[model samples]
Every structure is written in structure tokens, then in C-alpha cells.
Target: MGKREQAREEAAFMRGDVGVDGAATEEKQDAAEVERGKAREALLRGKAYLGREFLTWLLWRSESGEPVAAFEKTGLSVLFLGRVVLKGISGDVTELSARGAMAPYSEQVRQGMDRGLLVHQARLMLTHGEKAYEVTLDAEFLDIRAAKLPALMSEEDDSRTGERLYLAEQLSAMITTLVEAFIAVRAGRTWSKQVVPAMKEWMRGEEGTRKQTALQRAASARKR
Candidate 1:
């Protein structure tokens, strides 16, 4: 769980938002609902920076080609594609987006990462077995705004609906597992000792990129 959520739940517990035998009261339930509501609100309103952090971590992990989990025997892999929305924590150009096929790997997106911008929204292509599921993932809600399910082998309409539902459940399980992996690292001692350092190093590569670019320019000029 994220710090903000942990804090909120703790606050509720502190305030005794519990009923008989320490059961969650209406207020506590409302608090939980509030979180989901905020996620939905992110669609039209403010971004969820906490969730954005998770997405940013996922982006790095994905690019590093690290596997999050071994889902069943089929194996699940994630790739970000098409578009990525990034938002600055607190600075100029608070929000920016890159689109098209190569957007995820563009320099503008990397610069945004260098500027401490976390992912606000992104398109994910999850490959399970031999099929792929495409979805627009919202950072705050972890909601699937839209999805293109993998092709179904079912022939009848009802069978196709069941297949679709199964695919949706599979996607949800994949997301949950991915989030759990991030949470494990984040909640463990390795977060500050290892993960953060690794992420910072990933973010600190603009200098290298600039040097490479300069060398390319020099080589081009020499060719001229």
C-alpha cells in the first residue's frame, strides 16, 4: 500500500472509526470509498501522485526488461506503448504527454522523468501466453479506462462473453500481481537501499544522453 493510503487508514483507526468488535464503521467504509472516489475523480480532476510513483517504477522496470512475476505457466509480460502522460511534482510545465508509436521512448518523456515527473497515464500492452491485452491504465485508480481484450477462441455469443470476462479477470490479476511486486519492494528495506538508488540512476541519464548526442553531431560534422 502507498504511504498516503496507509496514513489515511491509520488515521481512521486512530479516530476509532470502528463499530462493534472493532469492525469497520460507516465512516471507515466511507474512507475506503473515498479512496476509490478519488481515483475516479482523477479522470476529470487532479492527478494521483502516489499512484503515479508506482507507475513510474513500473515504467522503469518494464524498460529494464525485468520480469515482475511468473503468472501461471503462460508467463505475463508488460510493455508500455503509444502514449505516456507525465506530470511534474512541483515546477514549470506541470504536465505533458507524448503520443504516437514511439512516445514511450522519446527524449521528451525521458526529460520529463529527469524533471521528476511521474507517469499520470499510460497505455500498456500485456502479453499473456500467446495473446496480448491492451489497456489504458490510469495511475490513480489503477482503473482500466479502455481495453482491447485478446482474441477469443469461443464461437457462440455467450461463450465469447464468458471469454471476455475471463480475459478481464486475467488482466486484473496481472495488474494486482504487478502492484504487489512493487509494494513488496517499496515496503521492504531494499526500497531506500536499492530501488530508489536504481531509479535515481535511471533518471540521471540525461547527461549521458546529451554527451552521446554531441558525439553524434561531431561525427556527422566530420563526415561533412
Candidate 2:
């Protein structure tokens, strides 16, 4: 079982209400739900690392050309554009930020990883057909602090307002869908068994060869 699942099970067991069928009692279940709700609230408040994990996984998938589990139907592709930030979560608290054309390929990112830093915020570009959306996604609360949506096509004031609202809703929905996809995978066995190992291997780049290899694999995967 993944760490998150194990943690939940252990928490339930600690409540001392396991039934003959090895199921939590109704009261225990209710308590567990309340705990889960609080955990969710904590994450939303940036008191947890789950948001950082999600952003890191998103970047890894984008770099490796792995298809998004939820956005397949939309034919949308996610790219890590310029302006990336990596922050140390423990001990000493270091912060590294990079921008410009070479930001994505900067050596500072790998160096930050070597020092136990994680992707704290990143600029992403999502493209679907002729429409391109650019946004800065924060790992703290999984919030989009800024976004550039496609130009509104409607000319009239009322129509333009409606179009703007529709675009905003669409953007929010897309972010929600992708985040849910990440959570589904993250809570599964495959995350610890497969995805995390690959991510670590990619992060420990030596002389840039490992990064190139990863990019090449991504390019090859895209061809198939």
C-alpha cells in the first residue's frame, strides 16, 4: 500500500474499533471522514506537501511526454514554460528561481534537487488546437496565481462578459481535472512502485546525460 493509504489505515486502527469483519465501526468511519476533511483543509492551507508532489509529478509527466490521465479526450498538451521555482521544504529552507529562455534547462534546477529542493511554482502552457493558455501554478495551494486566456471572440459587451466567464470556468475545470488525475495516480500503488523511482532517477542527473536521455525517451514516446 502507498504511504497515504497506510497512514489512513493506521489512523483508523488506532481508534480501537475494528470489527470481526476487519472493518471500521460506524463511529470510527465517521471520525475517519472528519479527519480526512481536516487533512484536505490543511492541504488547502499549504500545511502539507501533497500540492508540491502534484506539481512535481505534473512537470515530470510533461517532460517525459507521459499523457495526462484525465485530459486525453481534450487533446490538450501541457508544457513547462519559463519561470520555475524550487524550494527546500526542510532544514535551512533554500529557494531557487529561474526564468528566461533557458530556465527549463537550467543547471540550477538539478542543483536545487541535489540539495533537496522541490518544484514550488512553475509556469505552464497548455495548448489545445489554436488556443494556448499560459498560467503560473503554485505548489503551495495548487492555485493559479495568474493566467493568460485566449482572446475573447465576442464583440458586444454583454456577450464579451459571458465569454469571459465561460473561459474562466473552462480554465478552472481544466485545472481541477488535471489535479484530480494526479491525485488518483498518487494514491495508487503504481506511484511508489514505478513513478517515484523514475522521477528520482531523472532528478539525479550526471553531466546532463540523464536529462538528455529522459528527453530523448520522451521524444521517442511521442512518435509512438
Clashing pairs in 2: none
Cα lDDT tens digits for candidate 1, 2-117: 99987877787889886435578764345434544554455335346756877888877766444556777556666677789998768888899998665665667877887878
Q: Ten consecutive residues with minimal summed lDDT in candidate 2?
A: 206-215
Worst 10 residues of 1 by lDDT: 209-218
- The top-ranked prediction according to lDDT is 1
Off by over 4 Å in 2: 1-42, 91-93, 206-224
Which residue pairs collide, candidate 1?
none
Model 2, 1-224: lDDT tens digits are 89999777777778766654668676534644565455456666785377777777777677644445445376556767668888775767578888864465456675676677888888876666566677898887878899988888999999999998887887777787777667667656577799887777666763244335334533443443
lDDT of 2 at 86: 83
* lDDT, residue 47, model 2: 55
TM-score, structure 1 vs. true: 0.69
